[model samples]
Target: MAYVITKLCLNCKDIACTQVCPVDCIYEYKGDDPSIPKEMLLIDPDECIDCNACVPECPWEAIFEESEVPDIFKDDIELNARIVGKERFVPKRNPDDPIPTPEQIAANKEKWGYKP
Candidate 1:
């Protein structure tokens, strides 16, 4: 099964996942809905090799196997598949991407309703 990215990734565009993605399946998200919040990345469920390449790279702890996706982020499974083919998503990586600090990651998780 493919890996799913959850809301825990919101605003935490750490690209560490992108760097190690051997298949280059992860894409930058440009959706701006109120529910989407800040920028994040989406793994193209179609292109993903189920390699688990990105799971450890993400500092946000957002990526999970399709079956392991948290109940709160279950919708994200469909989201990743739906957005990968839409105009709002692209596989571009920025040269000056930000590396979030520990505190920022903790805050991001908290912002999305996770106590961690």
Candidate 2:
């Protein structure tokens, strides 16, 4: 199964995952928020070789396997796929870019408005 990015990543926006992504499959748009949604990370299942490279990379523990995820997090399965394919809820951020600063995180909250 492929990895999925869940709600726990909503405001965290940590780039730790990107650092360890050996395949460059984990990606973001770099401060552009093109979809006008929260600046969250997404794994490209199509590109992901299921190497499990990113699962341990996340400090917030937002990434998971489809079956390993809790029921409440099942929806993230499709959400991750959708974001990967359509960039539907994806906010633009570069995969190689640095994580958002604390101040930028706060500003992102204002722009994306995730639930606490």
Using Cα atoms with residue i matched to residue i, what is each candidate's TM-score against the true structure?
Answer: 0.76, 0.64
lDDT of 2 by residue, 1-116 (tens): 78888766776776677767677776663434454334677777787777787777665567787777766667777766654544333233356757555576456434534333
* Model 2, TM vs. native: 0.64
Show pairs that collide, candidate 2.
28-93, 29-92, 29-93, 29-94, 30-92, 30-93, 30-94
Candidate 1 to truth, TM: 0.76
In model 2, the Cα lDDT at residue 42 comes to 75
Tell how far residue 85 is off in model 2, in angstroms. Answer: 4.2
Backbone clashes counted, model 1 = 0
lDDT of 1 by residue, 75-100 (tens): 88987776566545444456687767
Q: Give the residue spans of candidate 1 off by over 4 A.
A: 29-38, 88-98
Q: What is the C-alpha RMSD of each candidate to the true structure, in Å?
A: 3.1, 6.8
lDDT agreement of model 1 with the native: 0.75
Cα lDDT of all candidates, in order?
Answer: 0.75, 0.64
**Inter-residue clash pairs, candidate 1:** none
